[model samples]
Target: MPQRILIIEDNKDLAHLLELHLRDLSYDVTLSFEGPKGLAEAESVDYDLIILDLMLPGMDGLEVCRRLRKRPAYTPILMLTSKSSEVDRVQEKPTNGAP
Candidate 1:
């Protein structure tokens, strides 16, 4: 079976593009336009990977990632950022050296 990917991007256009691209690669894709809904979906289902964008409505990606980690969710997260600050923030590993 194809691996499933969840994309949580507030930008409608980017989310659509990602869905199309991943679909072409034969991966099952799910899209969410807001952070709350995205988090709910992520927690409720199993996905091989997640492409999450920072600066989302309702909640930021960092908080989302932290929450996921707290719940022991080990899904690989690829955080998308338009700001250099956001990129730098995500690149910083936790003090415990977790992914």
Candidate 2:
């Protein structure tokens, strides 16, 4: 089966672009525009990888990452953000280091 990937980004254009590229690479991609919806999707399915954005509507990527880490299953997460500070903030968190 193709590897499943979840992308949580607020930018519709960017999300679609990413989905297209991932699909080309033979991945089963899922896109979520907001944090809450992304979180729900993450919980419902088993994804091999999760592409998360820093600034989201309901919750930030850091919070989402933190919550995902709390789950029993471990899914690799790749955080995408324009802000360099956000990267530093995520790195500071205790959750099992970034993937």
Candidate 3:
């Protein structure tokens, strides 16, 4: 079966382009324009991967990722954001003896 992917991005053009490329790679892609809608879709279906935009209507990508992580079903998340600070925040990993 083809791998299922969820793309939550507000940019229509970018979302379409990403869908096209992922489809070419034999992935079943689902797109959402905003965070709330995306979060709803995520809860309803099982996706192997989630591509989330950091800046979104209703809720931000970080909140979405946090909520997803809290769920029993663990899905891999790839955050898309232009802000370097946001990337840094998301990419941070705990060091030894660090909170």
Query: Pick by TM-score: which candidate is best?
Result: 2
Clashing pairs in 3: none
- Tens digits of per-residue lDDT, candidate 1, 1-99, equal 999999999999999998999999999999998888899999999899999997799998877777787776588899898887756766667632557
Across 22-50, the per-residue lDDT of candidate 2 in tens digits comes to: 99999999999999999999999999999
Minimum summed lDDT over a 10-residue window in model 3 is located at 89-98
Local distance difference test, candidate 1: 0.87
In model 2, the runs with Cα more than 4 Å from the true position are: 85-91, 97-99
User: What is model 3's C-alpha RMSD?
Assistant: 3.5
TM per model? 0.87, 0.89, 0.85
CA lDDT, every model vs. true structure: 0.87, 0.92, 0.89
Candidate 2, residue 25: how far the Cα is off, in Å: 1.0
TM-score of 3: 0.85
lDDT of 3 by residue, 19-61 (tens): 9999999999999999999999999999999999989999988
Could you give the candidate ranking by lDDT, starting with the highest?
Answer: 2, 3, 1
Q: For all the candidates, what are their Cα RMSDs to the real structure?
A: 2.4, 2.4, 3.5
Q: lDDT value for candidate 3? A: 0.89
